[model samples]
Target: MHVDVKELKGHPGAQRTLSRTVEAPSGLGTVLVGIAEHSDLDLDLRVESVHEGVLLTGTASAEVTGQCGRCLDPIGYPLTVDVMQLYTWTPEANQTDGDDEETREVTAELTLELEPVLRDLLVSALPFQPVCRADCPGLCSQCGFRMEDDPGHAHEQLDPRWAALASLADTLNHDDEDDDASS
Candidate 1:
């Protein structure tokens, strides 16, 4: 996804549009809550010269589909990004005429890399925690049963060790409450 600056230089203030279907990379930051699958992007990039730097302004939109984090349900979400970036061929310190007593140096070749920028924009647009529904009941902690699908299900703890601890804690809490009430 690298574009030659020389091509853009010829068409100053001209707009170039592109469309690409890209696979979402696998990583911690690249993984969306419910949108990690392949995405199709429609990009509109405009190349313009501004204050001696090349500026690119555009919009990118894509549809992403993946599994929900809470219930593992399939979900689809729309991702949109508005990006503005600047590229300068002239070195930063050499931009000022008086500051540089020596001759200005200009490179014949300049290229702009778009792969990283596109990846970041799409990843950032994703939701932090995506749920299948707004009021998902999630799963029961005791038995690992999905509570949303089962309302009347009762989870029984058969472990005597855990049961004894729970009972003792309840008894101690009751005694403290009784003492407080009496006092």
Candidate 2:
């Protein structure tokens, strides 16, 4: 996503609207969800010429698709992130005495690369734990059963100390029943 600012460099306040659809880039999301590569990405932005360099401000939107972190169900949604950045006219001008943030720089070739900037904004806006829905019941930890299918599903767990005795008692009862049937 490179924009040429050749004409806007010398004149401040000369702005132009940048509205177009481009292919989505890779790594634009977390492990659970993200925008697919080569997918449609809509950029609606304003590129203005400033005295220092160029100001890029607008929104970038795309469809995010992935599996839910909890239930592992397929999930998708549209995500739009705000973009605001200023590229200084020269690399040397980006250095400031007390500013810790790295300044954006317009290239010597009179072009601005928007990919890195958009990646930062979009990735930060993505949820760390993506969920299919707020009320998703997820899966049963013990059996991996879908909890939403049966909300009251459960397992009868026996105490480890009494498990052997319980099995013995069941075997004895079964033997007695077998003897009675034989008689």
Number of the top-ranking candidate, with lDDT as the measure = 2
Write one digit per residue (lDDT tens) for candidate 1, span 1-183. Answer: 555566556455655555555555443133435235454556677756444556767876777776666666777867778966666557763565453233222244666666567666667777787777888776677777888798777866568868888989999999999999999
Name model 2 segments beyond 4 Å from true: 157-183
Q: Write the per-residue lDDT of candidate 2 for residues 1-183, one digit (tens) a residue.
A: 899999898999999999999998888988889999999999999999987789999999999999988899999999999988989998777865257766699987889999999899888988898889998989988899999899998999899999999999999999999999999
Alpha carbon RMSD to native, model 2: 3.8
Q: What is the lDDT of residue 52 in candidate 1?
A: 53
Lowest summed-lDDT stretch of 10 residues in model 2? Answer: 94-103
The TM-score measured for candidate 2 stands at 0.83
Please list the Cα RMSD from the true structure of every candidate, rounded to 1 decimal place: 8.7, 3.8
